[model samples]
Target: DQQVKQNSPSLSVQEGRISILNCDYTNSMFDYFLWYKKYPAEGPTFLISISSIKDKNEDGRFTVFLNKSAKHLSLHIVPSQPGDSAVYFCAASGYTNAGKSTFGDGTTLTVKP
Candidate 1:
């Protein structure tokens, strides 16, 4: 089963604090992991990605860490801003596939003023 799981349906935090989201997977075949951020009625944009061979990847205020042994991953955003509020999806892909991804339902984050 190629299932990705984001247990939390939503999260709320104050601006300038750290925002964290967690994900898990059931598919052992996944070799590449990606994070995508989306807003209402818009397509998801690539945020960060990590290969199965690597443990972590970072981009600016966003960081993603993967633990292959646990089949787990997380995304962290520091000094979270109201603009950062959106839905985050955890995804997995493989070099074997033509860059298609399997995504979790998504976690909605809200940053308060």
Candidate 2:
């Protein structure tokens, strides 16, 4: 069974709206959660991240929330722009696992202009 999963294959939103992507994980060892955004032909870029010790982390227009009790996490993009259209992936890893992560398939977000 997959350790991490993003149920929504895709999402569409109007410009300046909020887009929320959800992720669920089955592993309890995950202590760090990360969100990455990827564009065609480009490597995934790190967005925001949250530690199991904190409930949320935000950077500019992006925000990541984690719920350890539920083994779930969500990413929120406020004022979503067309340029934000891309595939978002949720990743989980332990402190000792540093560079290694258990990643969700990915959620494609289409932000219309």
Candidate 3:
């Protein structure tokens, strides 16, 4: 079964606006939630992450929020730029998984200027 899922396959936002991407997981074993951004041919780059113990984590213009009770997580990008347009993948990992992560299909974010 697919443990992690990104309900919305695509999202469009205006430049300088906020882009919010969402993910959900059915596995309770996941203790760490991570967000990754990928361009066409490049490997996915780590964006932001949060632990199940915390509700939120922020770095620069990117922020990640986790709601363990709902098995939900979200990534928010403020003042989204054209460069921010890419496929964002949500991944989850736990100690039991040996650092291997379960990734969602990914959400394509398009930031229009």
Candidate 4:
């Protein structure tokens, strides 16, 4: 049914702390995974991505880990900052979809001062 799920609707953390977001998928064929960050009234910006062939990908303060056996993935933001307050969406693409991504409902992250 091509459903990507983000169990938590929102998350909050204090500045300089680590923020973790989780996602799950029912479709087993999704091979390309990506994370996007969105600010209010703006389109989502690509943050990081991981191919199913790999288990983890990291960029600066952001990291994404995939567990193929479990059909689960998670995003980690280190030292979360006030500027990081926004919505995060997990997306997936695969051979069946010709690289078109399907998105999760999204998780809103708030960083407290």
Candidate 5:
């Protein structure tokens, strides 16, 4: 079973608007969650992250929220710009995994001008 899933394969938003990306996990052991942004022909870059102990984390225009009880998490980007358009991947890791992470298939986000 896929432990991490991004049910929506894609999302679209206009520039200067809010973009929300959702993720779900089936593994209760996951204690850390992360979001990565990937551009074409380049590696994924870390965006924002949240620890299971915390419900929310924010960095600049990006924020990540974790709902431990629901085994769900979301990434929010406000005032999204065209440069923010990319494929976003959600990943989860447990202490026992030795730093290995389970990644979602990814959701392509398009920011329109």
Candidate 6:
């Protein structure tokens, strides 16, 4: 299912800069939008998330913005460090069954020092 899509396959940025990742979804039933960062040999680690009730949410250096009308979302990481380099994934889930999540193809980000 083309429920979610991450158009960018990869991104590169200098250390201490901002890293922005984009995501799009076709389902309007989605209630949650989340971003996860996965390093090699490890599972995806949750970064930030935004609920359908909220347009934007921020935690420390990470921010997640959701646009319900357009079915689009984005994750922003400020002052990204080299360790932040990884495969970032965008996932969506409906409220009816939060456990049933649909994920987009991940975008690999390289933060060069």
Residue 63, candidate 1: Cα error in Å is 0.4
Provide the overall lDDT of each model, using Cα atoms, as 2-decimal numbers.
Answer: 0.92, 0.94, 0.94, 0.93, 0.94, 0.92
lDDT of 5 by residue, 1-113 (tens): 99999999999999999999999999999999989999999999988888899999999999999999999999999989999999999999985562599999999999999
TM-score winner among the candidates?
Answer: 2
Cα-lDDT of candidate 6: 0.92
lDDT pick, better of 1 and 2: 2
On the 0 to 100 scale, the lDDT of residue 54 in model 1 is 85
lDDT of 6 by residue, 35-86 (tens): 9889999988888888899999999989998888999999998989998899
Q: What is candidate 3's lDDT per residue for 1-113, written digit by digit as tens?
A: 89999999999999999999999999998998889999999999988888888999999999999988999999999989999999999999995563599999999999999
The alpha-carbon lDDT assigned to residue 113 of candidate 2 equals: 91
- What lDDT score is found at residue 44 in candidate 2? 99
- Pairwise TM-score winner, candidates 1 and 2: 2
lDDT of 2 by residue, 1-113 (tens): 99999999999999999999999999998999999899999999988888899999889999898889999999999989999999999999997774699899999999999
Q: What's the lDDT for candidate 1?
A: 0.92
Residue pairs with clashing backbones, model 6:
none
Which regions in candidate 5 have their CA more than 4 angstroms from the true location? 96-98
| Candidate 3: residue 100 Cα off by (Å) | 0.1
Candidate 4 per-residue lDDT over residues 1-113, each given as its tens digit: 54799999999999999999999998887898999999999989999999988999989999999999999999999989999999999998895663499899999999999
Pairs of colliding residues, candidate 2: none
Q: For model 6, state the Cα shift of residue 52 in Å.
A: 0.5
Candidate 6 worst ten-residue window by lDDT: 94-103
The RMSD of every model to the true structure, in order and in angstroms, is: 1.3, 0.7, 1.2, 1.5, 1.2, 1.0
Error of 5 at 85 (Å): 0.4
